[model samples]
Target: MTNSWSYSSTDNLWKPPATIIRSLINCVSKNGNLLINVCPDGNGIVPEQAVETMREVGAWMKKNGESIYGAGAADYPTPEWGRYTQKGETLYAHVTDQPIGNISLRGLRGRVREGRLVATNTDVLICEYWNPEVQTLDGPEDIFFNFARPTAWTYPLPDESATVVAFRLNDDEGTRTERQRLDEVRMRI
Candidate 1:
């Protein structure tokens, strides 16, 4: 469910309605992908507001894309902020809004090896995992509140002013082997 807006007419040029963005987010939340279009003006320049909005979206995606690409519909029992996805033994948390300090996984009982901001090629940080025995997460709320880790890495977008970011989730046993087998088969052909 891609959300695209065209500036073919003046009435719609220069700005995409907020409803479009909201719908695109809804599509993403439902385990779908959004391919938004960024049309250039007659002078071949992107508007400044569009550029700023895209940057904000990219920042949010950089930190929370894991949940969007890796999680399933049932994985996120509660939707406090963003969507989520699960691949194999790992669960991803896609945060739309920047955390004030730290993010909490209230009902997660799985063994988490680590958690880190996506969109950057770096080592994954091994934070405290959820302990069923303890019946509570072992971490300061500030950690989740300040979830967005600043970095110099930037994602290359089709348009420099395009908004939106994405992340993937890596779980135990690595990627699914069946998908690998299919990839090998396609490559052979």
Candidate 2:
């Protein structure tokens, strides 16, 4: 509980903006909803700290609300770096941690039409044909996207709260490559 019905000195455990935002994203991704209770003091005044926290959350929502509102649980499982939420053919990747390399979406059966950072609308690399040898052995096609930067250099994420990457999917679902099929046949033979 963030606050009580009435103000108490020790009742509130104030969560940081990042924690609140991350919680909101995780709940939305898992086909769940979060209900926050904001209690006012005896004078019917909201706490300044609570208001500030909400302001930060509201700011993040102003930019990345599309990912949460009207979104359903993604067809795929959650990735190491973050969770995924889908609306129609589009999948939103809520990256909570700094990715070591490219953000990989394993077993993503949807073809990516485009991808971009939700906050800045900056284009991220959507490599469908990346690492053909590795992908062939993996069986299913994986979608990889992120700023193609060297891992040696430390780069800050666009938003520490949660950087959202929007991936517009195609109507045609992903499939195994011909090479993979041939390899399977060979193994069976």
Clashes of 1: 19
TM-scores of the models, in the order given: 0.42, 0.79
Q: After superposition, which runs of candidate 1 have C-alpha atoms over 4 Å from their true positions? A: 1-7, 12-25, 35-74, 123-189
Error of 1 at 178 (Å): 36
Per-model RMSD to reference: 12.7, 6.3
lDDT of each: 0.42, 0.74
Q: In model 1, how large is the Cα lDDT of residue 129?
A: 24
Global fold similarity of model 1 (TM-score): 0.42
Each prediction's number of clashing residue pairs: 19, 0
- Look at candidate 2 and give me any clashing residue pairs: none
Q: Which prediction has the highest TM-score against the true structure?
A: 2
What does candidate 1's lDDT look like per residue over 51-158, in tens digits?
A: 766776666556445545554554556446554555555555444543333344554322334454445534332222222223233442211212223211222322
